[model samples]
Target: MTENLKVEVVGLNRVKGKHLVAQIRLSNTGTEKHLSWAGEMADRTRPLGEIKWASGIGVLDAQARTWLLPYKPAGSPCLCSDRERDGLGQFINPGQSINVYAVLPAPSGNPATAIVVTPLAPPMLNVPISDEAPAGDFPDPDAEPVTLVNRRLILPAEALDKSEETADDGKDLQVNLSSDVLFAVGKADLTASANSIMARTARLIDASASTTVTVAGHADSSGNDAINEPLSLRRAQAVERALSALLTRSEISFQTQGYGSRRPLYSNDSDEGKRRNRRVTVTFAKPAPATREPVATTPPSVTGLTGTSKAEGQPIAMEIAGLRRLPGGLGLLTYEITNQGSAEARFAELHHAQDWEAYKYQAASNVRVTDVAAGRQYLPGRLEVPTDDGVDSYCACTDVSGIRINTEKFAPSQTREFFNLIALPETPGTLKVKIGPFRELDVPVQ
Candidate 1:
């Protein structure tokens, strides 16, 4: 194991015929920033378990078994890493440990013999370019980068189906519960359906390999931050209480936080948007297994669970997630709007792929801009939803309105997020952004 990065391979379990789950721990020994994909977009990093023989170099073992994919397929058990929040890889802080939940495929071989790991080289740091070149622009060509060694393992022949004492991997899992099921408007008390929602959520939490659980509450922008923040936190605590009572495992850690009117799933302008905005996001981080340990027991729910698909609907909502006037002359508006309604809503044209913004009622029509003094109206900016991660989701769109959904149908209870980069028209002073007939926000200029 290199001092820079140490990988501990605790155990290997066969999920099925040719697929396997590798439990690994990656630790940072040096002070230099170790790269993973946590803060980065999904497109930046390659999937963990995928191996391409055509490339000639990837993770392979003497047993002839190879890992081929990074995602947990339909039949695979719901691992905490599988349910983790967005971002690939991660950047581990010094003295930090990150668990990785990886899926791999094998043709046929005994992986119990020896497990080897070949991690991609760390990302190169960017050096600023001057008129000519920076002093350190060129690195020593003869320099040899450090190599990451794998943790060796030996599992019994029948270790495929049984639960091991050690659950390896250090990735966080995320599951969102509809706030509509938890509370009513202007209230923080748990609704009757709150029990049902928690029941489902607790099951998902209890079933995983994660030891730490964080419940974060969010509310619609209906109210100001003052009222929304505490209410949001209170809602989260309510959830924490339920989990404390229901989940009997003392080893599993639990905590809560509240972001009032902060992170909305949908626009707060419409009822549906507001409904979806009020939500609780539960995050679970998989516990890295101790070497030679086998999972003694799993939650009772793990065996009875079916399946959960988190990618579904979207709605253009009223609440603004972010609003910034860019340096050049344009403005960037980030917002969340999801279909909390019982049905799907169309805000764009599927046939008009090139004309993504074409709609009978353009969200641009619903947009309004006012000067700092509130005395003038400026030219409205066209809406363009941010597209860092493209549509692999059930329903999808980047449009702020008429977000054409249905690939997953704006199922009665689903939410998606979007941002708009609008032409700000070089407005001076503060600007009031009004979307639809409802939401009005103030953006100050420097």
Candidate 2:
């Protein structure tokens, strides 16, 4: 029964100007298949598929008197029971819930009176927010349960002030992806496998859309500008070409620039530094301001809690610090491991890699948080391939041959750092991080 499901607005924000980021939740109430609500025409009759994804969703801002549909950019990677499309739907499992993010126009008005969530597409699943639940009307509880389908959520007025404020993550979206992953040495052609990743990146860009798309290319100082400059421009143009095809739905103006060994992010003195410098940054323009308004409320502060942990006789010291927020509702924590012992140690083994399925497991799993008051433990959020919450430095940078590429050695006095990104809690409290099978540290939230 689609009606048995409840919708909750977990997070709302006006980012990149004129854009709204809403994190919503859908909960299923019934345990049996009779009330199951699948989001598809074919599966609507079958209770087994549960909630088929690509279920259309729309948002209505009651105060501003406008409606917003789910934003899906073409060629974007989508996944809900494996059916993800750019600007399409996703799935929701039974008992458990899933979070869906949609970008829309920021609703106008102080204390938006109410916001409504409507499940579009399948008419049977549509829950129109009208009045209270009908008396003794359960809709058989097994058929297309249409009771309590529409969720009329009230919006906050104070947080919706009509004053100009900068977005929390900033106005523009910049992604600096390593060129090595997209091209071969000194070439502008994309690898065969890179196309899929580029498509996914396109969708991410569409998520934070803009009227202008700029692809800036950089190169290591291996060659002179006379040669490197053109190479860099070609690379940027290649990216522009791919993006142009993927963002056909958008009317974005495309531009490309080549730095040609200039403006290096890292000193191109070593191979690793060169790898870091040879990169392309895709910048998307923020929307033009519709009107000066309080874009959003101050987000919860993200700070690092410095502490140390060690395993007996391992001579390994971990300085877990450098905590910060990620794009979504995720936070990242870093652990710096220093080998104080007389011999070298493999960094992978120290991280309990044996139980980690050979670096295939998401690095965040090594971390679990506990709310001191509730005594409930929370796991990491959903992540894509190379599961480890590992930063690029820690995450596998395998070549086309599928070989593990990393620098995971910690010699005496040498230090290596690992990062874990996990879903964060609202009104953050004192959180204890369970790291590996060896150590635990408490982080008090402010």
Candidate 3:
């Protein structure tokens, strides 16, 4: 139960055998007052009837590590409950149970289940997908379902540092090495550490089924193409030569290209983003799938540790419940916060953490998941949203506003829960979850 409301995820069904539709039943059990859907559930960034619709609703594809948002056809509104069009108004009356729905892009690869994500409630995990049509008219009956190309990140089990990382979209795998670590500034010659990076990359290639490897180089937005394009190509050539020497398979071939800031993984607005944009990437086909057990479901019980947060100058207790692997390729980190004192407590320390600084909104975006055995840390999952100007990235985690807690003045003895979505490792193991100002908890990825 979240904020005196009970939520039931009915099912995710296929519409026209192309689009995926999700139906959720929301019941208002709180006797105090009516609930505002927009204030609590809608994604604040949306344009129309934001408060009246669940436009921010998302479906988490665990296997692809992607968040599928409500899809809308060109020049049309989001395929969700219309503003004031449905019988329910901006608010849900007390003791009233209503059903809200959203149309999302059907996930590729035909996943068996998806994690339903709403603002205030605990994630509806492993909700089975059905072939039956939903009970009402489609949100946009005339519009056709178009497949949108989504960007996927390869969550690595082991990492050397922030300078080198890898991400995959379940199909192709990419190993991204920062140019600063691979070469001298403005030069294409391999640096001292390049050999070790290439050796590690060679091992990954040796295990892959692909015989042709593509090495691509990218530059930051600092210089023009004349200076960047040739330099990037040279960098790719250098990486190709090193890989050819280190790789054991003699028949494997290499293809190289230079993209001079034409493609970027992150926005170039900040220094960190710019540094990440300047990179050399090796792309190849992932190895064939092996027979493995189905993705595990989270346990129904709650068990965790509680600690105080003195950094916020308030008597608040932070509890890290546990980390459990969910069906599909993700993990759910459950936690809660309690205000112990009479005065209201604000989570300033948590909102200002380094990991969440980029996201100014009030959410549990600061949490980090560390694979204990692999010695690698991961942030919350990210999804790219197409905007008018370009694409924007957001953390695929819980937004605290959906939970019934005052952002500034958390009442005395008030406790609020949070659910964060994170990408899981290829193999199940123990995980270390770091919540705000709380000691890290050792949680098994069961």
Best by lDDT: 3
**Pairs with steric clashes in candidate 3:** 38-51, 62-329, 63-329, 154-167, 154-168
Clashes of 1: 40
Query: Of 2 and 3, which scores higher on lDDT?
Result: 3
lDDT of 2 by residue, 379-428 (tens): 43321122145222221111111111233455667765555434344444
lDDT per residue (tens digit) for residues 145-166 in model 1: 3222122111111011111011
Worst 10 residues of 1 by lDDT: 156-165
Cα lDDT tens digits, model 3, 158-190, are: 263766776655667788888989999999999
- The C-alpha lDDT values of all candidates are 0.43, 0.47, 0.70
lDDT of 3 at 290: 42
Regions more than 4 Å wrong, model 3? 11-21, 43-45, 69-76, 104-113, 130-160, 219-229, 250-253, 259-275, 288-302, 353-362, 400-409
TM-scores for all predictions: 0.32, 0.35, 0.82
TM-score-wise, the better of 1 and 2 is 2
lDDT sort, best first: 3, 2, 1
